[model samples]
Target: MNVCDYRKLSISMSYYLQLFRNNAGVGRTGTYIVLDAMLKQIQAKGVVNVFGFLLHIRNQRNFLVQTEEQYIFIHDALVEAIMSGETNLRMEQIQELKKSNSYLEQQYKNIIQFQAKDIHISAAMKQVNSIKNRGAIFPVNSYRVHLTPKPGEEGSDYINGTWLHGFRRLKDFIVTQHPMHHTVKDFWQMIWDHNVQTIVMLSSLDEINFAQFWPADDTTSIDSDSYRMRFLSKCNKSDYVTRDFIIQSTQHDYELSVKMLHYPSWPNLANANTIYDFIVDVHERASDYRNGPIVIVDR
Candidate 1:
């Protein structure tokens, strides 16, 4: 492979390694510790087959390698290694092998109906606004937090939010779309009502579709009737934008420290590997606040 291809493969390898642990229900730290020890053992002994490696790994530490895709990932790694100028396989042979593997992958996906789901997603279509095509939150996994509006309001108090459960039954986050101009007040109301400590805004304010809910200047603050949120500070990373916020209740004396981790270069899915560090940082920051759920604005 060329230099660019080699670099891409290296990035993919790292991403797949992380996914391997996730598939086996291992935490980030545990994955690193176990993989480090396993690699050392492999070096001491000799290279082994996929099953043999997995067996040794399971023996060394308790893990669950769930799903065929995880196993296939390991197989792909072996295939990649075999084709990395390490083996004497001809170009034609390598191409044929890759074609066979692709066929098998497609067959596996087709058997499982991986692309076609016979479930109804249009049941809540009535609640979806004109601007948002896929805005309906499934009632089963939706957040029940509704704004207690005063007498004269016409619309329902339901905000477009959903409770996102974290690993090991930890209910850690509430994710919602970017608030429209009409729903800005409702957004703040939801934050105050839910006692949300961290607010992760994942959209760029400069985007035409996105509304500038908060003031652009860090010196300025935005205030709702019940709450006051100010831009405390910001740190710009290579892959994402991080901002600290101080939200205080105008009615009550309580306050909250919010961290907004915004990744603007999304939808451009090439950033999947590039944003790994940013994602880790977000996780680490959110883990600090154990009392309240973090609000993730996905736009």
Candidate 2:
């Protein structure tokens, strides 16, 4: 078998640059992790099979593995290692690989290796799942958090959200995108339907591209077809602002106070310690409310 020339991996700058630019950030991180695997394959079988490797991440976050220009490339140094008949690939000792050709290599490297990803179970989670024939075993749709459909409206059940397992229950958390102007009403409907007690907002009300889903101040109130949200109080802190609201279901005879902790500039923490502290704070406040799914909104 002929040894692969690694430089053959490099394509024309115009083609490669545009691909990398389009698939920045999360795309970058996924590709490098897969590249690390590709290196090992080259050391053994002498081939790299993917142009881009990403987006198969769990939890229904996105479409799995969007690819472009399905092409296989070769690596030089690793292909030669088979001549010595050594099968184990020690990636760290590779001198040629030390040079970062792909800018995506460093993104989430430590977190990918060291982060705790296993699901945690609480007493409540077990209790909820123990209910006989809960229908969770056979989901009607793939959506994690299903919204109540508006009367006589098609596709009202659809929303850009997914349920996440938390310590409290199998579906204790709802992670969703920032609502656009059109979907803002549907957003409130889900909150009202599910009896969500706490919402964690990652973006500010004034931020670009994010619809102002809530009222700006304590004196303001926003009304929809099915619900009325009135500001109750505001607590300002260094890293976050807590806003309390009285949510009344206009259609149903029920009223509840929901608390929202908004992080205007999320993940702008000083260090890992600050990030950990922020998470702990959010969890603590969310637990202080009535038992319900905690809503986490994306920026």
Candidate 3:
């Protein structure tokens, strides 16, 4: 197929449909490939870690599809090529990576690249240090997570979290900073309200940056707003610790069980095989909450 067949554009798209799947040019074709890789990774494991996907595609060329704008060019061209009834290439499989080189060329104004200046102007965002990770990291207002305020806790719709688009099977994932002492109540509220079943705590429970959000001992219970958590059991693993909890709402006659997997240590890429096995464990444990958005906490 000729590289010039990308003139036609279509709308019905993949996980990228909400992000980018239109416009003209070859664009960053690697995005489609990376997204495809992401989908397969998630489909097989029931979830995905960005770092894992990055490492999987490291040796492959052109996997850096950063922005949504990059999705359309290559995706459209691939669609057009397949729609044109090209019999020579495996269009269904997206086997034509070389033909997309030309469409990948693009440039943008410096103003669009950096939003640091824009974030400095917002009052709430500037004062986010109180709620977030001490303002060590700033979030885009457009992408920030807004928790629902409890009954009388007006202006409680703030958390240092953001929703990210997930691949094929999964719709969205919430990423937030580690729950601070003051914000632990808010964190539990978010989990209870949002119906989060599986929480992947990537950060270790170190004293400095990360803190333990759940009950420290098996006999004690922790209360946050209307929710109360009693430690059920702890399962020790090689790279992580799986803790189960029985959470009950003090207000209503409702109780929800939550499973948290905390990584005490991480295996490097050198242990790719081990990581894949770990993915399977996470997949099985998270099956109960696969329908809802998985909450991920980082630094």
Candidate 4:
């Protein structure tokens, strides 16, 4: 029988067998026995047909599996011969093909090396630019660090304390190094009031908690914008968050916004601290660009 017939028989056998077994005592005894026997025969035939079909499929796939390597080799040889353009029977044509192949191989290697060198140079340039920018803004004594809070927990003393202490030191250094137009508090207030693109709180490694520090009903205040107030929370192993939050926050807060910096379970926090310091330094130095969109770089 065809596959369709085999499937039909298989389904019928299963249904009849189940019904016969369940209703063995309730149904007429002789009728149940007969039906059970009929089901057994149908089941046997179905099993045989299914086995045959499986064997046929295995045989069909066997050829494809066995000859795959050979096919690949043949394809490669044909491609190489075509690329060499050595169809003619002449010995000179064969020699020319060999030379062409060598030239092509060398060209490929050169291209690869050139691309690698270009990438290395580009990376180095980025590093140099970052260093130059930071040097111009941050004083010698200013140091920055990152703080991440635990999931379901409000901002703790440890996280905020670490950040606050580090930033306070940085402000002191700046005051010592240069004559400031305003006190540190005044500087920070200016940043908060003018919507300065200075500090960025990225959602690295987890979904961050975001809330407004000021009164919720103060619509006239600049901080009324939900984007102006952002915080990050680190989650446990089973937790997850979305990238949409970052994008939406960026849109709402034209100056400072949050971002997700996905890091491996065992990550180096040193880089995060460095980035935070760089951002602060940049903003302190280039106060003119504080109104523009803040760019946060994360690895």
Best by TM-score: 3
- Which residue segments of model 4 deviate by more than 4 Å? 1-108, 115-229, 237-261, 265-299
Clashing pairs in 1: none
Every candidate's lDDT:
0.59, 0.59, 0.61, 0.31
lDDT of 1 by residue, 1-299 (tens): 13332332222443455445445455333333434343444446755455665666668666534555455544444434333423244777866767687665754554454221112222223343323323544322123345666567533355666665666443577778788776676777777777776777777665556768766767787787778878878788877777777888888889977777777777564666657887788778767776777788866
For each candidate, give its TM-score against the true structure. Answer: 0.52, 0.51, 0.59, 0.18
Error of 1 at 219 (Å): 4.0
Sum up the clashes in candidate 1. 0
Residues 1-299, candidate 4, lDDT per residue (tens digit)? Answer: 22232232212333233334433332323332323333344446632232343245446444321222222322332333223332334666666667687766864654454222232223223542232221233211112211232366332101001111123222221111111222222223333333334333232333232222222232322222223343434332222221211111323434443232222322335566655654554456445443332323221
Model 3: per-residue Cα lDDT at residue 140: 51
Positional deviation of residue 63's Cα in model 2 after best superposition, in angstroms: 32
Q: Candidate 2: where is the Cα deviation over 4 Å?
A: 1-141, 205-207, 271-277
Which regions of candidate 3 are displaced past 4 Å? 1-131, 134-136, 151-154, 168-171, 267-270
lDDT of 3 at 160: 71
| Candidate 3 local lDDT, 1-299, one digit each (tens) | 22322232232344244344453323345554555554445446755454455455655644455454453334443433334322344556455544565432221222233344353324235454445545556555545666766577545777777667677444367888888878887777778777778888777677765778788877888786678978899988766678888889888999988888876564233566656766777678666467567788776
lDDT of 2 by residue, 1-299 (tens): 12243232423333334445655355444444555566666667866554333323423444222344212112222232333333233676566655655523543342244321112111113443222122223221233466787699655655656676676556788887777666777777788888898898887665556757777777777787778988888888766778888889787888977888887777666657656666887789776865778999875
Show the lowest summed lDDT stretch of 10 residues, model 1: 114-123
lDDT of 4 at 272: 61
Question: Candidate 4: lDDT of 104?
Answer: 65
lDDT at 175 for candidate 2?
81
